[model samples]
Target: MFYDKVFFLGKILLHLSIIYFMIASNKIIYDRNNYSDKELISLYKKLVKPRLIEEKMLILLRQGKISKWFSGIGQEAIAVGVCNALSTDEYILPMHRNLGIFTSRNIPLHKLFAQWQGKKSGFTNGRDRSFHFGSQEFKIIGMISHLGPQLGVANGIALGNLLKNNNQVTTVFSGDGATSEGDFHEALNVAAVWNLPVLFCVENNGYGLSTPSSEQFKCKNIADKGVGYGMESYIIDGNNILEVHSKVLEIAQSVRVNPRPVLIEFKTFRMRGHEEASGNKYVPHNILELWALKDPIENYQNFLRKENILSEELEVLIKEEIVHEINEHLRIAFAEEEISSTTENEIAGVYKHIHFIEKKPNQNTTEARLVDAISNGLDKSLEVFDNLIVMGQDIAEYGGVFKVTEGFLKKYGKDRIRNTPICESSIIEAAYGLSINGFKSVVELQFSDFITSGFNPVINLLAKSFYRWNQPADIVLRMPCGAGVGAGPFHSQTNEAWFTKTPGLKVVYPAFPYDAKGLLATSIEDENPVLFFEHKALYRSIYQEIPEDYYTIPLGKAKLLNEGMDLTIIAYGLAVHWVLDEFKKHQFSADIIDLRTLQPLDVATIYKSVKKTGKVLIVQEDTLFGGIASDISALISENCFEYLDAPIKRIGSIETPIPFAKNLENLYLQNDMIIKEVNILLKY
Candidate 1:
């Protein structure tokens, strides 16, 4: 009985210690009331002018003079406060609702007006809508429409700045709703791990569209989320302009000097509907009124008046000046013309064929395997391009697991030949950064299956960089695809079809060493982004002797590997290899066409080939449904209908997950047996 009593006392003591520590750590150490009277009033005036401008823009949008407007009515303090805190050199990744922040950053008022009007004078040259404005010269990375995706990009930008030893900070603004996305969590984890110079600002405006914060999160406050990542975080009165500015500046300064990421939660409210046309029926009337009383602009104005910092004459003069400035810019924007035809032609010319110096053809006429062709092609490419950077996991010093980039690091120093961390997203983001900054970054993903991790950077950012912002991102993504190597489901995947659906990206799969060398050289010289899908099984596949000198194969052009009168076999990458092998074994002299690029598809070649042969066979290593084979067959059936002698045939992997066993894997991918299916068509 005495021992039990002692144990209970010990437990009580331990509990007391934990409670004491929590109380000590949770105490607020910084206060916002320490700012000078003039500074506080200046911050208040800055936030108020932007909020009024947003209101006027919304009015214009409602009047149909503007297309759309994302207002930051209730959350003005957060935007103004953060912008005031950041230096001119620091970068900002603002979301759609941060118009106040954009204005504060000195984005021209006429550019904003032109953006709303969808004019060529707009920030994005009329490519994107009003909310997505960005300027490289201004260091604004642009707004991302998809919720929470910019967090990872912000981290990536910070990483680049850090690598260059630049004392610049990156601030990413997101709403309460964005915290739920997987990207947000992933980015936060990565930022914490690396301690990047980033500021994650969460504008907790009570509701994420219709859902309240209470239903979406179980934590007491969003700032608590930062603690899990071992980051310093704070909850500030977001409606209080002075408080927001003081806290943000403090954190921004700390981040710039020490280079550590911090999470700042602004407990604010949305004064307007989510968008200009959005209705407030879902919002509770009482709650709206309750939050409206704490309007950032009005509250800050009242604070300034009470402190005797803002005079009535000065406030009126400031309002008049803002109105006149806005009107002048609007008039200028209206007078500006739409994007000129010459500008369009210039942008279109970016994708046009520029002549590449042609070299002598390969002297050796002996047929080689696919792998040997790719290896030889890469070996030659390294010597061709002076700006080419080969980077991937274990691709440099290790010479790659497949030895495709063997001796590359020895030939080129570490700067040109880089080995990246296993983080696929970082690898792709870094490549995009390097490419945009004038280096031709050739990024290699060990297997196509791992491309999922880098999909955001590749598909959303790199692929659309040209279309969205008129910025050329010349990057080559090399993925070793297909499933014939007995490497399980994790390592072997033919996932090019997923990327094919996305626009503004070029996809290529070369079948022979000569073709590989030519296509790779073309991709390097092109100003657009390209995904070079190299089949693992074909890495060592030798082909007829390729030229030793530098040369380029035309993009969106197909080559006829073999010519025959009866039927045509349409294939690319490993499928081309399979078809050639079948032809040799069966003595079938069928016409074979290799689709060098997928996005700018060589439809002209396919149409001509099918028109002549009458019978067509489409084959690929991907699954049957929604595969590249299916797409090719549909195109052939639709375009070359009158010329067909027999119905188009398509052979692909069965519609199931790729298995680990060699037999199952073989059964899954298109093989010699599948190629034999063409014999039935040949009989017709």
Candidate 2:
């Protein structure tokens, strides 16, 4: 009993420290006469509009009028206050609950309702879920379902805007649950390091869905988490409109000038369930009753009455006007047509292609290796395109692992030749941010294997941005891939299959110095996000005299290396060189087709070759199973069946991960394996 008393007392002390040791949690910035009657009334209208919309949405959700809704019933003040503070030019990345952001930004009410209804007129053309659409016109970056990733995107926006010399701030929102995510921490650290102009707000609504703060975090407040990153933080009464408005407005104005990040923890609660359909039985009735009495709408109304700025009659008229507006918009949205089910219409704009001025193919008579060729391409691209920005780890001073960007720092300066932290995801997403804001960015991954660290932003956000909202991710991700030279499994991987399966991304795999130079140039110019794969083994192995001047090769087009009718050999990257080497040893009359781009697959060239040869062989440095070889093999067997005289063959590395030891690595990826398979196909 004595031990229990001591533990309880310690717990009480910890709780007291959490509340009081915080960076001034209970600061009152909102004065009684903070605004004149006109200003007060405007603030109240902005605060109440979302409440009326959410209340009506709950009714629609229950009656099955809408498919889903994540009601922000009690937390209207933060969205309104922050958005009110930001100018129309500054961007805001709001979460699912921040409906007031749209209303306050003056987004078309009918279109928002149409988006909720999944109509064609919606912002995302009904491709995205409700409240997950952006409007570039309004400077609103729509929130994704994975809430934490948006913080990194916000960093990208701020980063891009900073480069543009635009004095604009980007504000992003997340909940307490998202604070536990790595993105939140990484984004904050990046913002602090770069001194980016981003206002990070965490609406500490006491819960994330049904999970309480106790389960979500151990920190005193979400704002306290920001203090760890050396960012200024404040916790204010999120329920009070005056406090949220005044505090957020002041911070935003300050952030716009000073150019740094700030974290605000708005103290509020979820009065309703997470959504209308989800029950809230787990919440204690006492806690629910307490939050209900501190309702944001009710408290703000009382604050209005206390100041004598709004009478009961004026309040009723304001509410009636809001309801009428919502109803009038819903009437138009309800009559709007749903998204079309046609095949062509559905797939249109799912992938985008950008036009570029095709540079004349010129041979400047420069002897270069594959790595040198890549550097030449990037050099020429930077020289030609003023909007081009390059970022990677050690690429600035160290000039990258392969020295591809050697002397680039001296050539381009610090802004263009950026060395980034090991945070891959944040940089990739920031590239996306740059692309959307009228800049083209090229991001170099340290290795193809490390792409997993930044996979979410690539696949989920950049891959889907254009499809969802016509947001162009005009960025190139230079991925050094493949096995050999004892780099081992972790650094050596030919991972093109992972992205070829995913739409909205272009895959470029070039063999030899000439193709490498040309394809890198084109990949940078292409509007879509491109995965430019350069084989590590071939970086300096082969040499050729190629064009030093700028050139552009179209993506998805294959080059015929050596043509013959006896057999066809299909390959890309290092595999293409292996075939050429085998040809040097023995004169095998076969059509060697180098697939420069993998995603587009150049099926016409492939099918034509297979038809002429009537027997084909596909080779890759990657493992056999679930690779692009299997897909191409199937395509040939299905379409070129009648033309084939023998079974279509394929050769790839051993299934196990690339080994560390030289002998085991040889067994893992053997070029002689190609010889044995090629012989079998020719003999058959």
Candidate 3:
């Protein structure tokens, strides 16, 4: 009981220290000689504007005008200092608390206010409020709620600049809490490996939401971890704007020329709560008072006054001017048209145009393995489009894990056939960076199941790219999927429904070498993010004569491999081949349909086949519940219900984890199960 009391007291003391120690130091002017007194005064006045605006936003929040408000109260110095050091063209991916960075970039206050008001003129056009907005023209990526992925995005932009030999750098900002994320380590590792020009700034506000740094990280300083990644690391007083600006500028200049990543940890405190929603309750009263005394804006204001740069009259005038400007912007924002999606016409159409560039192809066929055909398709794309690139682990010299990208390194060199660190999220986020910068990227996820590790980028960034902006991320994520051989649960899994269910993503799973080569060729050129799932079992197992010349099979079109009036067997990937073999064995007369792409599904072809056969059996290698088969079954029921002679039958892997044992694995994913289902459907 005594030990428990001591432990509880220790926990309380730890929390108290986190709040108090974060702002215990009063060091303000370190390297004040860099900025002139006049410039310092001007910077202080500019800083005051954001603080005042924040206060105004809080009032608006109370008035039910603004949906949310994330205050950067005491941490303004970090954003102002870092953004000041960056060039106009340099990219900045800021988190919610870095409002000063947006203000520093001179983004119109009216536009920002409109975004808060959910107006049509807003940055995200009312698609999102808060900080979920960015300016492509200004090179400022808006803060997504998740912070870690942006660092990888910054690394990608830096890589693009490096590839072009352009003397530009990218500065990405996150809080100390973000350092614990896998994406942070992944992004830093990639930046270090490539020697990309990226400045990663972490504002150590001592807490992640309500959790203190003592509990959040097991390190002394976030910057110290950068040393492990072979990056230049530094820690400084984040409250001192002059010190931050000078140090960041020095490193920024060196990085712009030499090209290397630098990690800077700014020791600061968040004076306010995490956001408006989180009331100031977690912090102890005494600690809040201590931090209030060390307020960044107030400290800087005192320094400016001491230097005789700011007078009483001037201070008053500046405050009045800033307040008036913000009020005007708010007034304009409130009067602007409110963005609404409730209208029938608007709700009916959300996705952009999707069409294949129709060009007649020569019927020249050449026998090739699926892997070789994919390589050929990539080679042709690289030859035709200079901006096209293939990136993944062991893709360069080792020629990928399955030898899919064999001879690519020798043919294209390191710049084109880029080798990456084993950072899955960064791999896809880097693809996003390249796509936004007018480059097409084909990323190979070593195995399909590994995509789970990088699901954030795939779902949030890649999938949302087209829907957010009409700009399609011209990226193809090549996932080597499916379980046939004994590569257990971690390595082998079919994940089609995961992507197909997602709205803005296109999923293509070709069954034949002909479709594999053609669909891949088109996916590279198409203006949409495509998840090209290459069946691991079929890469070397299947061989066919494919078109030697460049060709593209239309995406949303199914191929009829066999025709029969008795029943329809619809499948994709290796399932198509399995169903065909089973039919041959059983001597079953059935119409076989291979769905080349899962999303933007060829429902018309399925309806046609179901109508002709009067019976349908959907087969998939994915798990039974919530699989692609369920959707196909529903489509058949909805569209061709009258033509059905039997209730729709569907076969999929058993609803359980894929086992390492051969027997259990076979039982989990068996073609015999599908054959039995087909037999039942035929008899019905």
The TM-score values for the models, in the order shown, are 0.82, 0.94, 0.93
lDDT of 3 by residue, 431-475 (tens): 888876678899999998989889999888877765564456789
Q: Candidate 3: where are CA atoms >4 Å away?
A: 1-25, 34-38, 342-355, 469-471, 586-589
Clashes (candidate 2): 0
- Tens-digit lDDT string for candidate 2 (1-684): 999999999998986565554424433234654578898889889989988888888888878888998878778988998889889888889988899999999987999999988888899888887878788899999878777788988888898888888788999998887888888888898889889898889988877788899898887778888878899999988877877888888888787778898888888877777776786787887567666766777777787788788899999999999999999999999988767777786666777856666677765568999999999999999998998999999998899999999999998998888988889988887887777678889999989899999999889888888999988888999999888879887998899999998888889999889888988999888888999999988998989988868898888889999999889999999889888899889888999999999987899999999899998999898898999999999999888899999988888998898988888888887778777877888888
- For each candidate, the alpha-carbon lDDT, in order, equals 0.77, 0.86, 0.84
lDDT value for model 1: 0.77
Q: RMSD to native for every prediction?
A: 8.5, 4.7, 4.6
Best by TM-score, which number? 2
lDDT of 1 by residue, 1-684 (tens): 999999999998987676666445433232337778667656756776787677678778768887877667878777888888888777787877777677787878888788878787776666678677557766777655766567776776676676667787889888898888766776787788777888999999878887888987999899999989899899998877777777788887777789988998888778677775775677876567667767777666766677677789878987888888888998898898866557666456434334656555555554555555665666667676666778788988788888777878888877577776677776676566555434667888888889898888778777777777776777888888877778887888888898888767889988777788778777877767888888887676454666665667888888888898888888887887788878887777678988878878989888888888899888888888998888888888788899998888888888888898988887787575645677788888
Shift in Å, residue 570, candidate 1: 2.1
> What lDDT is reached at residue 36 by model 1?
81
Candidate 1, position 156, lDDT: 61
Give the Å shift of residue 187 in candidate 1.
1.3
lDDT at position 310, candidate 3:
81
Q: Rank the candidates by TM-score, best first.
A: 2, 3, 1
Stronger candidate by lDDT (2 vs 3):
2
